[model samples]
Target: MKIKRSAATIIGEVSALILTFLTHWVVFYFIIINSFKTRAEAARLSLAFPKKWQIIENYSYILSYGDGLFFRSMWNSIRLTIISIVILVLVASMTGYIMQRRQGKFSKISNKLILAGLIVPPSVISTYWILSQLGVVGTLAGLTLVEVATMFPFSVMIYKGYMATIPRDIDAAAIIDGCSASRLYFQIIFPILKPITATIVILRSVVVYNDFANPLYYMSGARNSTIQLFVYTFQSAFLTQWNYLFAAIVLISLPPFILYLILNKRILEGVTAGAVKG
Candidate 1:
């Protein structure tokens, strides 16, 4: 049997979609238009097209400014994101597998703790103090740890939920094949975890790459800055240059946008699979 939507329902859905598109496009329009304007024109923050287009000049200046600090910051963000994602994926996947396969008091306690991690906000002061004690407060390594720790709980939950849909017979068969625990997971189970892993990688990469607050709070003392922090350099007490800022914003936004465009199909598939299975 085929069910058709009424005219009223179709109109409502269309109206909602148009409203959503306009809402997002308005903000994107402001950023793009201002990016092409002169500093004075951008400062006005008008929605009109630029009176004097300075797109090339603005982009060139932004790229060349501060001895190429923008690119350096981009590199820093890339390094952080890469390291953090690798560590998060490995540790979270393994932990989730263990928590799901092993049923015990310890697992129960761990589940509660993981749930607490999701509910509770991180304590900046305590985290900084711990990093200070470890003598890594101002280093990239420490910031990477922070990102992994903060994102771990959510990733674990996602993996654990997906893992529940897997049968124990697979594990039994792997063990019967004389596979070591490590080999069983690494060779067999991990490969099967591709769908959920893809979802985690895509979603968490965006968060870690674009993170602003954590870098500001934890990495403020560091000499190197992430892309988000680098963009803040455009602001000053005397005057704020909106054109240069918008130009930098556009440039910095490209990497993640391109990444999404390339992997959008995989990302959507992974998410849908996780949703259905989990």
Candidate 2:
């Protein structure tokens, strides 16, 4: 009975893996093959291979489009992503640590608010009004703040979970050694949080980089557009340049795809560390 059950489990796992691979590969293949095709060929959106590859033309045009708007958008995306992640990591990690260590009414209320942040749907109109009042509605700084706010709750939760696994004896020892509160957290605790920090950074970098809606709502115009918005140049109400669009998508997707491939194991390890290690 045990042997049969083991065989059944193995078969189920293999089947799920094959299905996932095929599903993802088909989408990947379609986008890539279309990216190399001519505008007319790509418009058809068929599964067939391109008769004449326009690799250089398609990719080059996308790069040089609108006096290098693509490059500008790419830079904007990188900048926004970096700024947001740094702020989020600093603020969220500290907040998580405090919430875990301290016990009081304020901490309890803060915890509830964090949970509310995760559950509540954000209001674009209200956010716009607030940003408009502050005159940061269309700037990178405004968008950076928005991204940080949006990602805060999840990061805090992750940190809090992982922080629980760390023994309180460490805190007691550090306090006994004449460490100030700030020093204890920043010097002792923060360094120890490398695993969770890495998890938050890698995971949130991908999210902020690939974000479409937040950028669309908070920031506007060609000058301030992110990579996701850069794709809009190839699309229109009357007509869509399918090949150029696909090429732009390929370029936008590469960073996150490469990141996931390189750190996939680390991401898994970080996420599971709290649960498994403790």
Candidate 3:
């Protein structure tokens, strides 16, 4: 039996939706409104729209810095995100499977260590010390390693949860068929892990792509700057050009944000699955 919608319920639902829409758009409005004005015009009022749209001018100014390093920084971010995600998937999948399937006292201790990484603040001092000792400061490899170490625990935890959900029968079947562990994982199990993989890709790619602090401490020089570090530099320049800054900010943030909108459902499922199994 279908129940008819009440007028009060419909009104309340519409009101709630309107409130949500306005709340979401208010900041968007601020940025989009300011993104059009000249520096003088943008500062005229906190909430004012541009009297004339200088969007192109602002973009030109932001992009004109140092022969267009903005594009190069984007390239760096893409490379870092891809490499880090691939490494995390491969290493974490195998490690999580082992830890979950081969449960033992030592595995429990190892699990605790991984959890410690999550609970504790990343040890800047220890990282700096390691960098100093290895003489790898200000290098791309150094920055990459730092990112992997800092981000590894989250991926491991997620993968461990997922490994729990995968049946041990799959492993046993592959073994009975004379398949090696590595072959079984990559050819069979890895394929089955796609849903969680999508989740990891969306979630971790955004984070590693957007992380600024790690790059600030580790990748200081211009030669190896990721997009996040590059964006920070744009923000802190002497002039504080609001229009150009917002334009660059929008450009910097567009890719990951677009990706989120597209794959948000899958990402949500991955997170939910991880939480449920974990």
Please tell me which predicted candidate would have the highest TM-score against the true structure. 1
- Tens-digit lDDT string for candidate 2 (224-276): 98998899777899999999999999999988888777767677767888784
Task: Tell me the number of clashing residue pairs for each predicted model.
Answer: 0, 0, 0
Q: Where does candidate 1 stray beyond 4 Å?
A: 236-238, 276-278
> Cα lDDT for residue 262, model 2?
71
Q: Comparing 2 and 3 by TM-score, which wins?
A: 2
List clashing residue pairs in candidate 3.
none
Task: Please give the range of 10 consecutive residues that has the lowest summed lDDT in model 3.
Answer: 232-241
lDDT tens readout by residue for model 3, 40-79: 8776537776778898888887687767788788888888
Instruction: After superposing candidate 3 on the true structure, give the runs of residues whose Cα lies further than 4 Å from its correct spot.
Output: 1-23
Q: List the residue pairs that clash in candidate 2.
A: none
| lDDT score of residue 100 within candidate 3 | 83
TM-score leaderboard ranking: 1, 2, 3
Clashing pairs in 1: none
Give me the candidate number with maximum lDDT. 2
